[model samples]
Target: MPYRISRLGLVEIRSLDLDRDLDYYLNVLGLQLTAREGKTAYLKGWDERHAYSFALTESDRAGMVRMAFRTVDPEDLDYYEKRLKDFGIKYDIIPEDYRRGRALRFTAPSGHTVELYNEMDYTGNVLPTVNPGPWPEGLRGIAPPRLDHTLVTAPEPGKAIEFFQTVLEFRLSEMLVAPDGTIIAAWLWQRPAPHDLAIVPGKPGGFHHAAFVVDSADALFRAADILAMHKARIDYGPGRHGITRGTTIYFFDPSGNRLETFGGYTAYQMDPDSRAIRWTQDQIGPAVFYYSQELNETFLSVYT
Candidate 1:
């Protein structure tokens, strides 16, 4: 059987300071703010069914525990539910909401909560918000039409990889492991946009930075300059990663969750059943370091 994932729908991150965080994502990042409720807000970078790439929920603690992707339609949701049942996996369905739109939630084998939503409630008068000023000139913006991927950390890395492959129908495109087999990392995707999600073994239930693709290397540098100019701390490299073949830079938004911008990544197109490929240590560096020089020790210490 074939399974298709259309797009990353909405990422929910818990936040306590909604005003400051939302300002950074909307005004600075240039995502168009669409709608607002009491503590929840929606913003989007490109034209889509809904208002945003990420939805912020106010809380004392902040972190992402749920990720939603879009299935083709109601029938597609049924097909996915059936696929989960075939493997004896458990899930929950969320009907339409004034808040989340429409979606179903299930736990991936690695016990990551995943949701699939179809419709984004629309209002007739949707327009791109005022240009939040020029996005640091020469800086490539997340050029991909939409938000593409998120990297998640799982304490039980091996089981997580199995769950994504068996229950969610994601195929592994590449794998990186330490020589001792203690820390394992694998990249998996449903479509050709490189890995939509990557599994890294670490603190369970924690999210690594979500990645957005840039239009050009110039955008990447401009983004770096803008970030530095704004005094936003840089967390990781402007260096290239051999494994993903992308130039990556990491920083925390005013919100504190790590965010990454990349210029290039290898795209994978293969049957879900294709054999998984592995990368040696030399190919991918010692580890996927989250904190780079642009980010200072103080910021790095907080996440650790």
Candidate 2:
């Protein structure tokens, strides 16, 4: 049975120091701190049940490594778990840490850990506290409807991509491979909103970035202006990506985790049989009026 995932619920990451990184997400990036327990912190972009985003203990080894999503129903979760057992896939049931209400944890085929929560723990909707436009030059928040997707570093992109398709029922909206058919990068989508997850070549078990879908092009620029003031240097963006057809801006957090604010993504809700895609160096380069430099050393090293 194919798992019917409704939408991305929240991302749970292990941070070395909760206060230091959580400070950037709350005070700098403008995510509302909905709740906190010991070393764990739950954050919110907009109001929902509990928190849709959070960070837990583990600041010493900094990297985004976990994500959580909402299932269409409890039956879907059971269907997925049973299918994993039938196919010989192993998973775990992690209890709600201070933030997650009731969640089950497991590792994806690519070796990335993910959590599935049936509901958000809180009662009220936690919306963005910062008014994006009113802020000075560098400090701004990404005004998105909710959490978008995540980029993960996978040792075997093929295995990872396959797991999402075979196990999670994610469709491949776009794929890029080398001459030998080694999957370099993949963009998968569950609904019309661009990609729900991205696969990049890396050592298994770490996150690349988590993206937020902004409402408009104006929000993209406003986000950049605010980030610039806060000294959150731009990794790339304020332009269109050839794959998702979305205008995006990439930057790093105080902890060096990547984050993107995007708009104008082509909806894939219509065509179920979309073709695969590959991009050339020129396609993703500065010639398209986008800039790049030695400054992108970190992003390029992991992605390219």
Candidate 3:
């Protein structure tokens, strides 16, 4: 099948304390605020070309509202619509918004809202395309370059994995399976950086973390310093992950939503003959946190 989805485009998350969470996102994480309407604020990385890749909305609770993926072309949306119809999946057509075009929205088998779109209003990057420096000046905090993948929780991850693989055409990159062949966790991707989405066993519709991309291992450590300076809740380490081999540090926003700054993962090409790397449940600790070789109780239990 032709690759329909191009890459992860945007994620909208709810915040219990918008002002407090927004402060952390702006000063500590260094996301550029693009626009605001009512209780919602839209933001993007300094290097993102789209109008916004992250949206924070005021709410009484914290969790993800939806995640969107950009399609390869406008026609791909129509193609997927047909496939969805054939599969008896229900969806809605969302009209154009401030900086985004029409979107097709649906709830995944995991109960997470998902959107697919082909057009977004281009606002350009922080630097000029003609003659740009390595980075923009006045950069604060960690200042990651772009948004990375997201991890969510599902009661039946195997079914969710099947939906993404068979319906959305995402390739499984890696997975953690029980001894009896049940899926504990699975990583699926359309783009090159290991996983665009990952699913773990938890409450349906649970939000784990949305990761941002830093440049290197040094940058990952720098992120730790910045998080400490801002007094953000550091959930886990400036450590390595055996799954993607990425350097990472997990932290929480003021609203208690988990976030991560990650780097150094090997790019995954969609090779037809390639099979997903597997990790048995006995090795779950190393599969998730390479440095500790153990799972923290909070890491698996806590989610927005």
Q: lDDT winner among the candidates?
A: 3
Task: Provide the clash count, candidate 2.
Answer: 18
Clashing residue pairs in candidate 1, if any?
43-52, 139-219, 140-219, 234-294, 234-295, 235-292, 235-295, 236-292
TM-scores for all candidates: the values are 0.81, 0.82, 0.97
Candidate 2 displacement at residue 190 in angstroms: 1.6
Off by over 4 Å in 3: 265-273
Q: How far is candidate 1 from the true structure (C-alpha RMSD, Å)?
A: 5.0
Whole-model alpha-carbon lDDT for candidate 3: 0.88
Per-candidate Cα lDDT values, in order, are: 0.66, 0.66, 0.88
Evaluate residue 97 in candidate 2 and report its C-alpha lDDT on the 0 to 100 scale. Answer: 61
The TM-score leader among the candidates is 3
lDDT of 3 by residue, 154-207 (tens): 999999999999888899889999999887889998876688899999898999
lDDT of 1 by residue, 150-200 (tens): 877776888888787777778777788667754377888776555778887
**TM-score pick, better of 1 and 3:** 3
Give the per-residue lDDT of model 2 (tens digit) for 1-304. Answer: 3337767776766665677777677665677667687766767665344555545454566676577777777777777777778878777876566644566678886776787666555455532445543323432265454577888888787888888878777887777666666667788876555578888778777677777766576777888887887788678877666567666778877656678776644333425566566654434443222334223456646421
lDDT of 1: 0.66
Model 2 weakest lDDT span, ten residues long:
286-295
Is 2 or 3 the stronger prediction by TM-score?
3
